[model samples]
Target: MPHEGEATPRISKVQDRGWAWVVLVATVLVQALTLGFPSCVGVFFKDLQYDFRASNSETSWFPSIMTAVLHAGGCESILVERFGCRVTVMLGGLLSGVGMVASAFSKSISQLYITAGFITGLGSCFSFQAGVTVLGYYFIRRRALANALASTGVSIGLTLWPLISQYLLDEMGWRNTFLIFGGVMLNCCVCGAVMRPVPDKPPGPTLKSCPEQSREGACLSNGSTSCHEEPLHPSKRAACFQTLQKYLAFDIFCKNKGYQIYTIGVSWMVIGFVLPLIYLVPYATLNGVEEHKAALLISIIGFINIFMRPMAGLLSGLSIFTGRRIYLFSMAAMLSGLSNLICAISSEYSVLVFYCIVYSVSMSVIGALIFQVLMDVVEMDRFSSALGLFTILESITILIGPPLAGLLVDLLGHYRYVFYASSFFMISAALFMGLSFCTMEAKNKLKETNKPPPETPSKGKYTEVPTELDHDRNGPPTVVYVTSI
Candidate 1:
């Protein structure tokens, strides 16, 4: 029994199935609604450009800002902690819907930037962070598989949204399409609703001062208390600053070496990671493929990815990839780089199809393992902070990568150079991560070799034993002695 004021330690309830799988489904929907729409922005590229009379580089800012905000939005973890995943995601849904609805009324590119880029992007960040963070709350052993399964929402959205968006653009025009997309985005509220909050560990018994009872005699009301207990109100300014610090998670970079290495590698990789995706349709059309056919290529990538992501997740979770998921991620990055090189050289439709297949495989493998690797390196309690820092760092590349790729396209009067640049950056990122992995392995090996040997049960003693048993009529068994120093 606990003492008068003592509390029982609450074990976290980690359910691998039941409500956990439901959370996975909700997370998948949230991801589809939040991430899927941005990926299909490629289908809107031409319309956006023509309507606003913007150059490729200028128009690229829409997706760039959106992507940047999506990543930078990881800071929504503070909201998740304060408001809970359900409310945060609901707020995100409302903002995204409102942004899209407002975007339909925009007469200029700048308005689109505010409505589509900043508002929708901010909403996406909230839903994404909440969905991902809540996912980690539900499963431990099966987290990789769950993440993979949830990630398929992106592929599904990518596969379907392009077709839908293209059709909508043809019939309704960009303005009406934005209006409808806003409605579709509102479904995220449903997703948020389904995200039943996973119960956190209950707080220990806390003593509150009682005027009648002495401090020593103060009694705990219950064996457990609410973890959500509010502190006595503090100064408003101090509270505001504390909230900002909690949300920003700025200290993670200073404290975690492995996380820092991973973040840097991811940041570098993002500089080119999605460049091909952004430019694929344009590149294909430049090569004389029909617009519809080029759009189909994205669907192809999505279709292949749907299967590939789950497979990668399941395989990585197996014992074979234990302690070496980062190596798998590195290999995937290298393969993606090679795929980009293939895309750079290939103009034929069939060859581009092959490139899509290869790219899909690489993308799926990397996506499935990336978060798993991060989670493996960071403690569960710190995942939100680490992820927030990672997103903010990666957002720098996301914001600039597309515009720079577009600039290359404009300068060269071709798309091949952009692909080449992407390939180079991706390969560079792979090499950097590979080098980091090798260094980590070497350090681990050195530690192993330098580890002190186990103490012997009998210190400084030598023991003798028979090497073999000899059964003979006239001879006793012979013995052999072994000594340890």
Candidate 2:
């Protein structure tokens, strides 16, 4: 028997199959639209450089800034949770669409930076976070597969966007390409509108105080206790406002060794991660591979990634594997690093292509699993806040990683060293994650083997509970209160 709150397979009835399919398709479509722009930047790089007359250094800033803003939007998760998914996402879509439209009118590099990188990135941040968060709540047992399926939108968008952007660039020009894509992005609003809220389990009732009741007595809600208090007075609500005195909650991120492991491993791995993808085509072209052949490499990578993500999810969910998904992910990361290292040494283009295929599979699987690991470390309720803190802290790396890779390429005058360096980073990440996996295994085993760990003193805190006999019975449920001393 599955333990309470342990994940159980929720096989849908045959009659609901059609509705499930609809949800799956709708979710995946929204993710595809949201991710298209960032994933297709490489295709636009050469054109943007030519049009703007920007140096490689400057052009790199465009994508870097865009990625930075996207991560920075993690801070908005508090708002997303408060406002509900539909409204937040629809607003994001509008913002993104407008940003694209603004980008189309840019006449200078700075203008392009502001519109394409900043504004569009902000919109994308909202859409991506909200979509992923919603997916987490909607499905439990199938979350891995659902997330994988949804994430494939990146690859699909990558596939179609590049081809479309290329055609538009040749036929109509970059400005017109942005205009058309901007119109296409307006559909994100429709996507947002379709994302219905996921239902939450009703919590047990809580009372703020029972002053007249004996300490050990249970006070029933049906007037079992007749003591009356002064009529409840409505308290003034604090007006929401933004402030600049932001502080990094380093303690939250640092206190959990698992989160530390995840953060370090991901940051280290990603530093070398995007470098290869970003430069894959250029690397091939420099090696004398034909242009079309080089482009096809990315398509092949994307296709393989499309399959690998769900496969990782499915594999991770299996009970037969001792449920050691993190360990498996560690191995995959190591292999990806090794593949890159080999590719760096290979002179034959076919060998390079083979390496690309292997790396693509590993990278995609790791990407999908990484967030799952994060969810495990931080429960769903705290996920948004943890992710926000992670983003703000990890933004430093996200901002620096690519430009540093570009610098290495410029200095070394080749990308082979980049691969070697990236491999080292990935190896370091793998080793750290392997440690985390071991510690996690030991902890879970201790928890299961009838041994009780020592207890720690509690911190006084309170949480809001939505109280209604049935979760769906009323409008938004009323907030019940609790006290901890």
Candidate 3:
């Protein structure tokens, strides 16, 4: 007899159709709700400043903490592994709702730091990671398209959130607006409701599969009752270590050069990537642009990205971009840096508006390809762990990006310098990643050409987990890659 959820096979055969579409839609909504809020923080920046009598650095802490906490990759990986994505997402939604509702009553920025920044951010972290993880599991043939589509939620969230925040602030002030945000955040639970788990590999005969483990009392005890819950201190430590190994990509960090380069490059890029989102509206407003128009600058980014991001995704899905997508992503980051530099030239209303459009064009590609590139670096089974580590590293940069910019503003007393700093970081990071990846590709190609052919033919199927990618019906054979336990 089959074990629970094992009667059916891995969803690969059934992926990209039927219930996968439902999961996709839910994932999109979840992504929008979580990722979109960070950028929207700009719309409320002034009111927060005026009401709390806080400095730019103090205000920066709120979003820095929120966005940082939201990328809790390590924590999220453990949660997704233990309880699965569904429970983790609903739990995040509930916590996020509480955070927002509590923020509405906060008497000080410090309290908002706890409630709005940490709690809500932690909630979003759970929802975003789990949603993205499930979406990956559900599609392979259309993986790029699905990711591109899901990523649009970020743009959608970006577009609608600012307008919503501004309108709500106008009608009922920030407190009531936050109260409403709490309600909006709760919808994550509804999205989580539909993310059914994909089936895992069917169980093998217990004794036949693991004689050594049984002998060591790992899965059995004295040929009687199981001893899964009770173990000695050392055994517990060993078990914990194994779980970390299996569920976290600590090993990948050390072994995979591609993963290491990707993680580091992305992490470094984030420091510059996040500054403009937090500071753009304030910079525009400070330079004498009207409040509503300043907000519109950000909205323009979302609007342009709505179109550009999908196109980027579709382009990535093609065979031509099979191995070249990373270069495209790098170019986008470089373009973003160039656009930030342009902002330093002038803060005129029309000039800032032009800057928004150009920045949006670059970021659309970045947003679509960022996580998708990570997916390319690591196989699916290891993706959760890889992403966990990736996010944790990037979150550090994100947590500090705004505050560092705020410090620059505080010290130099000019917003233009933030753009300069942003440009420096982005340009340098793009160059580093682009060059590093290009070198790796060239080395791999040279190695392939120099290697000799096999001396003898052998026939054996791969024992490790294999992902059956249905790229084409009559094209080449299925491409197989090893999946870690």
Q: In lDDT terms, which candidate is top?
A: 3
Score residue 42 of candidate 2 by CA lDDT. 66
| Candidate 2 clashing pairs, residues 3+ apart or interchain | none
From the highest lDDT down, the ranking of the candidates is 3, 1, 2
Clashes of 3: 0
Inter-residue clash pairs, candidate 3: none
- Model 1: which ten-residue window has the lowest total lDDT? 476-485
lDDT of 2 by residue, 1-485 (tens): 22213212222231124344455566577667766556567666767878898766677677777777776654455555456666667777887889899999999888888988888878877777666655544444454456566777776765666566656767897788898878887777787777665332222224334454434433222112223333366333411211111223355465666666777777777767666766666677678886556656666776776777667667765665434556777888898889888778974778877987898878777866665556556434445455556566555566677677767777778868778878888888898888866876576566647766336311111111111124223212211110000
User: Stretches of candidate 1 above 4 Å error?
Assistant: 1-23, 136-145, 198-202, 207-252, 447-485
Tens digit of per-residue lDDT, candidate 1, span 9-119:
221332466777887888888877887777778878878888999888888888888878977854465576556778888889999999999999999888898999999
- Assess candidate 2 and give its TM-score to the true structure: 0.75
Q: Could you estimate the TM-score for every candidate? A: 0.81, 0.75, 0.83
Error of 2 at 73 (Å): 4.2
Where is model 2 more than 4 Å wrong at Cα? 1-23, 136-145, 196-249, 320-323, 379-381, 436-485
Error of 2 at 153 (Å): 1.9
